[model samples]
Target: MTQFSFFSVIVPTYQRNDLLAKCLDCLIPEIQTLPAEQYEVIVTDDGFQITAQEMIREFYPWVKWVAGSRKGPAANRNNGAKYARGEWLVFTDDDCLPDPQWLEAYAEAIVAEPACLVFEGRTYVDRPRRSLAETSPVNESGGYLWSCNFAVKKQLFESLTGFDERFPYAAMEDVDFRLRLVKSGYKFSFVKTASVCHPWRAKGGWNKIKQHREATFIYLSIHAEELVNINSVYYLLFALRSFVNQTVPAILQFNFTGINEAFLEHFAYLYMSVLLWRYSLTSMKSLKNQ
Candidate 1:
């Protein structure tokens, strides 16, 4: 009989050794008391740099490290999942610090709810947001299954095809997965005891916004039927309404952050709408010609 771990914590990382080191420092000690056979940790690096490799080798040699697919976090996560040898695959980002009782909380929850397969863990942000632009993947009450901290049965993850690698960006991939899971109709238990601390991540810019728009496009395209009632047109109208209702008010107040976000997010929706309209027309034309 082959022995397998009850939980496999798969962390997807990319070119952030400093953050990854701090995360590992907090994560490893949490699992130390647990039997090694019961749990395992795997770090999948997208960058595959020598510094991180050597750091883990010299300091934390017990943890498993593998090369990420270099595509995106979604792909990297899928790559990490391939190496998982546990009943449950718990995913957390490399920048998150796991609470001391994180693994044990999940273990206890599994024992308590033997029928549950999906689990959403709590993600606490350590710092206050300086601006609305400074985003963080924090889930306090657990409706938001932010990829920072969540666990799903290995069987279910594989059955649902894991994170949709079709997403070119990390924007809507998790949302896509969540939508699929919701469609599956399994109630995801929110495990508040299983927690991780995530620092505020300042990741807003024009380029990032554009990438997010692309991902949203793919998400809408894939879920067109499910969202047929309120698809891209509804979002485009919402963006227009936002500009009229919120952006103009923020402009009068002279809030730079609000104004900046309005330009970055609201206006981009109009841009995306035009792009999508053109794409649809071109698709129709190509099909007619063929």
Candidate 2:
């Protein structure tokens, strides 16, 4: 068996111990197939309670577990990167389950291009409603690169100072990191074969709304320039009109109508407009920072 002497897989996790356990279960068999001594897995627990630690010890004894000092995801990732012993750091989320060939592909890609700074991989949502719909061309400018399936050279990661902890929440930090890499003239190759399946769960309305709002912050933080530019003004105006059209009818539903079709249509448009504005703001902020 070919040996990889220096590679580390770092997974930053929160309170999702069950998910983490499942992810590790999927990973261990793959790990066993590789040259064991040369590769390591680091699970950085982001200040979970004692129960989480106990669970990790019991369920994933072979993987190294690092306790996060009350840091957010960005900080947690940075901490894991700090202690990584490998020349290359493969980052994935706690919820992602990589294919068995995942690490093998990374190793192959590294061998093919030893000087590559970043490798962007593909992620497939498990059981998509429509596979054809899932295969659309992703807009890189729209921040499609997910942290759940990306690899970077260790030195490059350190040089860039890892992820910007300024993005405290779960949203746009990845975009900020990618933008920095782009500015630094680092090359990121899209590796379609290195895939992971991201499973979904039922989300409540409040949960989804919060997620969308945070995503707005992320979009604004990274895309500030576009927001201020002339093209963005047109998009902004359209979004404003859409928001008004949607919201006004929905509000009118409270007084004049009782759950009519127009109310639903308007509410949907209003929600879409909110997302558009949020993304525009993120793009505008990113431009300003540049």
Candidate 3:
């Protein structure tokens, strides 16, 4: 067996203990394939109500559990990276279950391209059968990166300082971080054979709107100029079309009953747009000051 270097798997979890349990179960056996002392697993609890300490003790005695500063996922990940003891940091969400050959694939890729700073992997939904979308090709520009299945050199992570904690929600922080990495001349390779199952269900209804809103804010923060570009007009049109498709019928049916309720529920998108504009102006001001 070819020897592999040390690796640290960091999982930043919020309130998904059940999924986390399964993720850890999948991780242990994969890590065992490497030198026993060359791997460590760290789980950072992002202020989830349940005591992760006890859960770790009971189910994952070999893993390290750290109390995350009551910050969002980005901050929790940064905290996890701080405590990692390996030369490479592999990030996977609490809800992700890795394939049996996941770690081995990463090790092989690292050996093939030692200068690569980032390793991107494929994700499939946890289901009985794979769909066309599950098997689609992925590249860096296609929004193919997910924290659920990515690996980075430890020194590279430290140099970049991990994910930006400024994003308070589960949103576009990942995009912003990857953009920075790309700008810094870092090379990333997609390891299609290394895969994981993202078990979280798709968000819909008001929850999805809120997610979009949060994401829009982060998007605006990083791409303020692009928002005003010609392409943005097309995006806004698409968003408006979607809103009308979702809301006009309800309005015509005198669903005034659900109007206020719906507004309260889905208004986060509008709020997020407003905040994005505000953040953009703030960023501009800071740039001017500098």
Candidate 4:
């Protein structure tokens, strides 16, 4: 029996107690499989109307619950890390269900690759074809290393300062944080065996699209020159290609659900383009006023 380091599984949640309960139900059992003192689960609630603390006390007495600042995941995660007593900070969402061997796989990886400081676990949706949330934009590896199933040494996480709270939404903040870590020469190890099941929630309509569009605009705003370089010809051509490639396939297959999803997916890009133009105009106006 090889000894493993302690891990704090940090989950940042909003107002999804039902899903959170299911997630903890799956997770608590997995954590308990290891040594009693080897791991702890810390859940930070981001201003939920119905907090899970009562439920946590009743069912998950071993897990730690904390109050969130109601800012976003980045801030919420930072708060969770503050109280984590483990040497490794394992990040996962309140909606994810870890595989039975998830912790064991990570433990094995740490022992096998002591030189590796960061680990990215695999994540997948069972029926990807059923929902838009299970599409291309939702990177399984989460671009670099998803917060939903990745582990980092507490020291490395601290040095990276967790995530940038400036990103107030659940968007590219993970990518942004990962990019910074990559730039800092942190090597990533993909633990294919350490997996988590992230089931897609019900589609939230165009409001969800609009929210993602804003997040895209924020990412674009950071790279303003790239925004300027996206020519109208290329944009139109790409949109046309996407419609034919993505939307047409679903329409041909008589997938009404998929057709609507594909349309919205394309619309997100188009809407973001419009937002970029508006932002550019606003910037120009500010420059003129200056």
Candidate 5:
């Protein structure tokens, strides 16, 4: 069996002290269950105009607080990993509340899959739903895993340089990293027991949609092949297909909640598609000049 020395829980926060406090609340007790040297919690603040150091120190004195560069989430995560002194690097966002036995589950998985370097824990929302259609505990989705909850060997994380800071935000950086790791032939195992609760808060505005559109372009550009011969209309068609796939079954089953969620998802896609297509020409020109 492969033996790991310790685990480092790396959380990147940006002015989310309240949520971070909740996260630490759940994590600290769990860590206390094991020996002190078994794991360390490192919170990296990404250029918060007002630091969380004081609050964290007062309430969660066990946590290692690090002031971060104004760089985006990816950079902040990388920064946290740099200070980590563990054989395994466990990542969870400040907004996530990990399960009581989250660490034990991951430790077990590591032993079970001795050859695997990457492992993803499940994340779901426990709060009341907005609509029956809304998705919660998104890590339940079988597609790509999010960095919101996962673990990798410290050596391996450093080998990939942690995350691609070029993506500039919490967006596509996870997807980009996963794709690259998969291409490099690394197997990832999902441990349902190592779950975390990522609560949802409805942000009422176009700002999120705008961020999605911007991230979509950045995502495609990073992939290179996806950007080739692609236009806004292509994304529109893609969105239409996705909408049908998501909403049709719900409609047939008379699942109003599911249908509502599907509609919202589709609308967001359509909105981004139009915005992306509208600026694709200008965006491409700018990228080419750079």
Candidate 6:
């Protein structure tokens, strides 16, 4: 064998022991076909909760556990990757449940396309999207390389320094990674059979819009020349498009219950605009100083 393990499945968690338990329950059965050395499961925790560690020690002792950096999920994941001993590094969030054929499909795809360095897996919520307020990271057709279900060559991931530790938030790090991989000229393949189930969350998404904007700005700050649009006009266009697509639909519902989400959308956009302005001024000032 070329590696101690062909695949190292790394999951990042933050105080969600129950969800992690469910995630592992599904994944454990999927790897029973292969011997212990052929595959490894790693769960890295970023929280102070030792229940997860105790649970893993008592029940799933075969799985490897690591302490997170507590800096953020990006760093937590990279720390998990530090302990990986496989040819391929597979990533999935603690809330996800891999399908029975998930690893099998990836193995087959890797064998079929030996030259491919990265693979995007299919993610779906089995339930209907209840409301515009609900959110899930669903990548049905697969151009979206969501971090919850993807694989990369260990060497390439290390070369890119894994996810940018600068992105201390849970947002846009995956997009930044995908952009970097594209810039490096590696072809990406989507493995439709390598599916993972992401439960649709009733939590509203408008709250995350500002964080997304900040993350996007950070990404632009890092790759200004590589990115196409990095101006005030681009931020305006993004806000306009987002309002039309997201908030407009919530407002069109004509229900008082939807008003809160609509209001949050407006507030998030306002917050993002301010952040964009602040980031632009800082960047320009730094450039002048340089």
For candidate 3, the per-residue lDDT at 41 reads 90
lDDT of 5 by residue, 1-290 (tens): 44445899999999988888889988875443445567899999975577789998888888899988768888999999989999999999988888888887888888888898999998888875554354444877445668889989989888887788887766778988888888788878888988899887544335555665676678777776665444567768877786577456556565475555456667777776676666667677887999
Question: If both were scored by TM-score, which would come out higher, candidate 2 or candidate 6?
Answer: 6
Candidate 2: residue 128 lDDT (0-100)? 34
Estimate candidate 3's RMSD in Å.
6.4
lDDT computed for candidate 2: 0.68
What is candidate 2's CA lDDT for residue 70? Answer: 59
> All candidates' lDDT scores?
0.80, 0.68, 0.73, 0.78, 0.78, 0.81
Comparing 1 and 6 by TM-score, which wins?
6
lDDT digits (tens) for residues 243-268 of candidate 4: 88766676655556656666666776
| 108-190 per-residue lDDT for model 3 (tens digits) | 88988887878988887654322111121223232456777888999998999889888777777777778778878886888
Residue-by-residue lDDT tens digits, candidate 2, 1-290: 55553778899988888888878876784443455665688988885454357876887788888887555788889988888999989888888877777777777777777677688777766653321111222223323566788888898999999988866666667877887888899878877766677765433234444554565556555665534442334444655674467435554444533234333333444565565666656656876999
What's the CA RMSD for each of the models?
A: 4.2, 7.5, 6.4, 3.4, 4.2, 3.3
Q: After superposition, how far is residue 122 of candidate 2 from its true place, in Å?
A: 1.8
Of 3 and 4, which scores higher on lDDT?
A: 4
List runs of model 5 lying over 4 Å from the truth.
Answer: 1-4, 30-34, 132-137, 141-143, 228-238, 241-265, 274-290
Q: Clashing residue pairs in candidate 3, if any? A: none
Clashes of 5: 4
Q: Kindly report which residue stretches of model 2 are placed more than 4 angstroms away from their true locations once superposed.
A: 1-5, 29-33, 49-51, 130-143, 211-215, 218-223, 226-290
Which candidate, 3 or 6, would have the higher lDDT against the true structure? 6
Q: Which candidate do you rate higher for TM-score, 1 or 2?
A: 1
The better candidate by TM-score, 3 or 4, is 4
lDDT of 1 by residue, 1-61 (tens): 3233388889888889989998888767544445566887899988854436777898888
